[model samples]
Target: MTSPFLSLPGAVGSPVAQHYGAPVAEQRALDAGDAAVDLSHRGIITVAGPDRLSWLNSMTSQQLLGLAPGVSTETLLLDPNGRIEHAIRVVDDGERAWLLVDEGSAEPLAAFLNRMRFALRVEVADVSADFAAVLAFAGGTALAALRALGPVVEWADPWAEVTRGGTQYANGEHAGAEWSAVQLVFPTERLGAVARAVAPAGLMALDALEIRAWRPSRVADVDERAIPHEFDWLRSAVHLTKGCYRGQETVAKVHNLGHPPRRLVMLHLDGSEGELPVAGALVFREGEASDPEARPVGRITRAALHHEWGGIAFALLKRSVPADVTLAVRAGAEAADPQAPVEGVIAAAQEMIVPTDAGATRTIPKLKRL
Candidate 1:
């Protein structure tokens, strides 16, 4: 489906705007629930038939059996060793379960689910070409126009706080205490109707808010070795005591008797140069370049210039990195001198997201004799 937003002046990139010229204002408006974000690039999949919920509940991280209609939640598809494979946003509309995912996810996720269908009475279909998703805060100004699409399907984000059968790893007041993100899915053909109804906010605006919310996305944060504990994801996506699922053993073990090898941390970047480190940039301790062979303490997964927070980013760092240390993000090596230190890096401040002591809840008794 072609994005209706492509024609708007100053709009750039695929269906969604990276920015509409004035991104700061757009960010403020979206956060205040006064504007909408174009997420047409995302994918939607539907699981139909009576066994949809239970079948999914059997394989993923969430407890989805008997999931009530209109309720929003997320789940994780993990590898056998507990590494995250996919993170899916879930909502059921009485007739079928809708799985909303990032753009590259639908095909593989559908194929995987199909392969696991076995004797289940469920059928999965990738309907991304038939529909699109738009983001708004609950009760936002854009709703009246969007609702005109005739009972558009909506998925309320459960990230404002922990949902049932979940856990919170970050302590104290959450920055996202007021977050009320909602996704409205409508027919792709109605794109023009939406374009006429409300103004568009780019992905950057949406991303800044997500960073402030400390939301962990599959497309942005997960890596080859990502686990639920690393992003403090057990709070909304993992059901600790639910029936068996893939990666359940590792999830239980990490939470019960071990810590995630890495933890997610926020990097408050220095934007005085109007620069934000691009995603995948390496993060290091201040002046750690003294040892050219030293490994980065972490890698920046997402970065954005916020309307209020200036330059900000989210990184997955070693769990042992001190919480208060000054850090740096190596944007890229300078072209003139690849070995030059201090040429292409930006200093950063470490804002702890996942706590250092993130796991090992069930203590084992120690014996004096060896």
Candidate 2:
């Protein structure tokens, strides 16, 4: 079997985790100093037309009308009911806009955009197979390396545009500090040059970095039933007043009045190490039966062994759960196969405590003037 990490310079390495999972160390470096992620699996949707700007503006929560060359913004593709179908980072190159999103959202998002193309001269295609996208977090030397590669075109705070020769790249946050969510596109033949230029890594490192930074992805990291508010994607994605879109009403109402029934929190485990909670396990504050089974206080989203915290995890827990709550991971068993009970309790295998400042306040600029 192959290892789950990719080698890189100035770091231990990156992750080779499935496209959906980034390793815990990569996530930590990303949040603390500098790091990079291979977004080769992310889906890219291209939209071009005179109506592209206005049309996309009418649909997403981002204020695309003001987007100029070399700038980017994160937004959500919401269902009619305000649930996030997917989260996307939008990049405007003046002539065309690119939607960078989760790998799973490619087909559905393409179909949605294609179906919406009525009189508007818009075309949407799933370009996932065409591009080699990677995300980098650099400051000082790393930033200099990137700037040497291209002209810094625009700025969206941590996100900016840099172009080298004629190739264009977009920069954004993987965790924090100085970062660049870079994309390189060309005939598949030229991928080697791009890889060498940027230093390729695996998805495991990216997940590690994401865990440290507290960035939650949709797949195993979150329940599909989760509202966007719960993940705090609104901090970076949803614009307060970008006019109306599909689920703007719910977004607005929830943002102003109601709190999300649950929230995403970072957890530190006791790590006694008998049987840890897997990615989709149920988490109970005190024990089961206190709450409906369907209504678990939280679900274990991403779990990884941290160099500092030992066993660290990201969970979507109820707001009512105490920060210091002792939680248990309920083990699952199959029928007729009773080495033990199919639904046996792990018996306080680990104490689940929220990491300090998991939900700290962030100050975002009102405008993209930079």
Candidate 3:
């Protein structure tokens, strides 16, 4: 399908309008629920048959056996060691269960499901080509507009609180308690009509807001070594009481007797220098970056100029890094326009997203003196 955003002014990216023109303004609009994001590039898959929910419950990290229609939840597909491979947002509508994932994830997930189907009844298909998604926050024009596209499938984010049988590794109330992101699915052919009803913003707008909410994304935050514990993902994606599935051993072991070696943090960059470090910038302790012998303790995964927060980012750091110490993110020379380079270390204050004491729920009893 040709992008409805292809010809949009100030649009530039894989499709168009990564930001329509004014990114900060666009972000403000999005926060106020006035705009929707064009997500034609995202992947959508469907699982159909009488055994759909039960089969999925037996394979993934979330409990889906009796999932009611219209409820929104997410699950993670983990490798044997409990390393995250895919993060999937799911919704069932009686006939079939929909799996919404980041771009490039639909094909592999569907293929894996196909091979696992032995007979009992389940069908998997990547319908990304035929269907497209529109992203919106609750109670806004974009959400209302999408609802007008009736008989549509919608999935609201389950981030405001911990789900059933889930544990929140992040202490205190969730920063995103009021967050209300929703995805509306529509036919690819209706791109033109949908575009006309909802005002469009770029993906940048959506991402900036997510950063402020301290949301951990699979594509941006996960590495080959990433486990659900590192990003505090158990709050929404992992069910502690669910029956055994792949990677259950590691998930259980870590929850009971271990801690995630790495932890996710929200970085409050010193925007006084007028520079925001790009993703992958090196993170150091205070003034350590100047020493050639000193190694970075972490790396920025996502950075954006938030509408309300200014320059901020999400970084994954070694859990041993002291929480009270101010950190540094080195924003190097600008390769795009080097005339006035942004060559300097940006001071960062850490906001703990995942605490160092996040896990180890069980205590081993000491043996009595013999």
Candidate 4:
């Protein structure tokens, strides 16, 4: 379905945003709570029935059974091997539990939840078609206005602190402590009116804010091999003391006995080349002029030029790589051109997001065997 924002002048539809005319101006307005962004592309799933909370608590890596109304938390569905499957943003209104997910995931997630309902009084539905999500930075007024449009639920992100039963790997101050973005869900029919009610920013503005906060998102930062420990997701998503779930054993072992094989890092890129490296670009450690054995140690997951930070990226690198290492990202196309022999690269300075010794529990002293 076409977004209602397309009716606005200079509206451009991309996979992420429905941006109106001036994106920069829109971004400033959004940051100041003078505008909003249409994020209707994100999916929504509603789980209803008396057993909603218990059923969700038993299936994911969070302590959700005691979640209070309007309280926001996130949970992760992991495979039996502890690899992340889905990262869901959750909120409840006492009677219904809402799961906000990445685009294209609602149907499959709801289907999975339905299959798990065995004699349980639960009903799962993909309600994405009925509701649209609107986000605003510092959006108290926007939220108050959205509440008047009919059943609306606001989800305040809990990224600033370590949630109960979760662990923190990043030391010192977290970059996301000031993150104040909120998600509001309203009737899909009100989408056009909502778009017209306020100035609108593009997804690019949202990306800059998220990256600056060191916030990891499912759609942009995750892959098949991603584990919660790698991205420091346990900060707000995974509960270490939660009862047995699909990936409980692996989660326990990694947190208590071992470190994650890889870690997440932020890269400050050299924008001198006038272009940014695309996702999946190879990241290599700085090499000596005569060194012929240098190999890529990581790959870029998300890259964007921030209004304040210039070119910045989040990448997954080998845990063994030092936090202070200087790196370079290959700028050439993934498939080399036979006609064009130039191979471009961008230099990047690494900023640690996940610490080298992330799993402190592993350092606990053990008893000597006889």
Candidate 5:
């Protein structure tokens, strides 16, 4: 099972592409809508049968029973404790419902769905081996041409606008307001030919764009303790009024009565240390030079050096941490080693992504007196 993309010149791979030689140049090409990235590393799951929509709606956070064909939406599977377990990008093509997931999750997710179908007329299949996914940004012409070739299902990102039954926690203009990215799924056999036909961009380009948009990627952002509220995922992934589902009680209670214990923030690294902090880097409150015991308030989830914005990252921090607070992230260190702490601590300025007062449900009236 050789990847056709690996045959391309300058092809590099891990969980995603490191780069294709000129990382900056490739990023620019992608930003200008002149390139496409091979996202075949991602997995695909297909659910077909009459009960597909209703069954899915009953399981995840999003409202999917009425999901129109060609409409793109995302859903999350949470534990009963409300911790995020899985985040799925979904779309329907009239006949079949497609679930696009992170690499290594297809088999388990498909199996879970299959087991959930006791006597329901639903069939789930792991089709990752049969299909290839390409992510294209500003790739209107190439995408249209690809659609003409055969049946191509494109899931347009709905992050640009607040979706129905969702709540937006960010105030003012958000970077995702202008985000224009789409996932295109086609037969795996056509991958090599499609790569030859379209302009090729590396995964670095995709990472830069996603980070700039403050897009929360499941694989990158979700940890064992992550909840949807922490990332403001209700902005696009959860339906507030949706029927009962696992973790729905927690979701409702948090939105109406409580606040998320942590919040997601974008950090603009000071870049004075001449290095970027790696993911899982511990973040601390900026303390005095002599105060060697600065308290840790957060941990970096994703970090990247943008072509234009320099170094930036997504960090999940204690919700009490102010939106305007300056922080420091330990950089160039072995995150796995606790005793060998890195000396270089990079300064970072917080840009609020999720507001402090994010989840105040309107249904909950202001209490006058007890």
Candidate 6:
């Protein structure tokens, strides 16, 4: 599908195409004071009617009963088994709710909701095409500038908000670290205005910024069959005490009991010498064979080049692998840079930890579902 924002010059095969309906560049610029993207291509599903909030809360991870109008929660859609079906963000306005999910998962998610719907006073529809969304990122003064425009609600995620307007809107969630997910929406007629208002940049830069932001998303890269715990999303998406929903048992059990069999880790790969290991490339620890067919310790979930760190990639590594083991990613002999060898290159692997005080060690036994 062509990206909706492709007309801006220099956008190629970007994921933004799925949401925008055109092939425009949707990523942010690195050096700018702030950056933005046309998020219209993303899936937006609306659920409304009398049972909106109650019905949704029963189905997802976040507690939604008390979610005030104008506020939103980022959540997940889990399968009956608790494996992640999709990662979603929900914005509510008392009367209605908007769910932002991965582009590829949009249609399937809508279908899932439709199948789950029966007599409940809830209605669901895919609004992604009708409403175009853009993301803006700024710290310090930029947030204040955005706030000056309208009523914005900041959520528990610290640097996040939800705002709306005719040709402009602002919602900053997960904006801390280096980047924020900002949603700017307007009529297609005013896309240029929105783009100009938010300094449009090519999608390539946006991908890089996304890499820097450390925002975990479900994309073609990670795909389904990935448990949320593998990405450490339990901290951000799971509601430990929520009523039984799809996959709640697994989500709950995996958290309070034993550790997840696998964990998400960031790796600094030696990529300057060859094509960076592609997604799905097997990552091997020291002493693992170098043949292209060798069993991998893990698979690369996401990887990108860091100007400061050479090549950095997020991998879902087997928890059984010990820390400090040197890892290797595949580099085909034909394309591998002789300098950046397929063999002998050392990769650093470290579990992605949510930083907290290092002093306490607490483990709680599993609790039965509510």
Among these predictions, the greatest lDDT belongs to: 3
lDDT of 2 by residue, 1-370 (tens): 1122233334232233332233444455543434444555557778888888888888886667767767666777787778878777777777778787776788888898888889997777787776545455554233344344452132232222221111111113333333444443333344344345543334655554556555657655655576666765665666766789988887777665565667776666666653445676666655652333334566777666654656666777776776666765555533112232336444333332222223322344588677
Candidate 3 vs candidate 4: which has greater TM-score?
A: 3
**TM of each candidate vs. truth:** 0.95, 0.72, 0.95, 0.92, 0.94, 0.77
Give me the runs in candidate 2 sitting further than 4 Å from their true place. Answer: 1-35, 140-187, 274-276, 286-295, 331-370
Task: Quantify all predictions' global Cα lDDT against the true fold.
Answer: 0.86, 0.57, 0.86, 0.82, 0.83, 0.58
TM-score-wise, the better of 1 and 3 is: 3
Summarize candidate 6's per-residue lDDT along 217-266 as a digit string, tens digits.
Answer: 67744555677666556545767666777788877676555556666667
User: Candidates 1 and 6: which is better by lDDT?
Assistant: 1
Highest-scoring model, TM-score: 3
Against the true structure, candidate 3 reaches a TM-score of: 0.95
Model 4 agreement with the true structure over 37-137: per-residue lDDT tens digits: 78889999999999999999998999998899999999999999999999899999988999999887888898899899999999899999999788876
Candidate 1, poorest ten consecutive residues by summed lDDT:
333-342
Deviation from native of the Cα of residue 85 in model 4, angstroms: 0.6
Error of 4 at 155 (Å): 1.2
The number of clashing residue pairs in each candidate reads 0, 20, 1, 0, 0, 21
Give model 4 RMSD, 1 decimal: 2.7
Q: What is the TM-score (0 to 1) of candidate 4?
A: 0.92
Candidates 2 and 4, the one with greater TM-score: 4
**Residue ranges of candidate 5 with Cα displaced over 4 Å:** 139-141, 288-292, 336-338, 362-370
lDDT of 5 by residue, 1-370 (tens): 4667677788777644667788778877777777778888889999999999999999999999878999999999998988998899999999889999987788888888888999998889999989978877654566655555564688888888889999888889888888778788989888877777776778777777788888998888889988898897998999999789999999999888888889999999997666877788788888621134556788898887788998888999998988877888876666423444556678889988888877766466678986
Order candidates by lDDT, high to low: 3, 1, 5, 4, 6, 2
Candidate 3 lDDT by residue in tens digits, 1-370? 6678766777777754688788888888888888888888889999999999999999899999899999999999998889999999999999999999998899899988899999869889899998888888876677877788762699899998889999988878788888899888888888778878877789889888888888889888788999999988899999999879999999999989998999999999898988887777778899975555567899888888998888889999999998888998777744112233335788999988899888899999999998
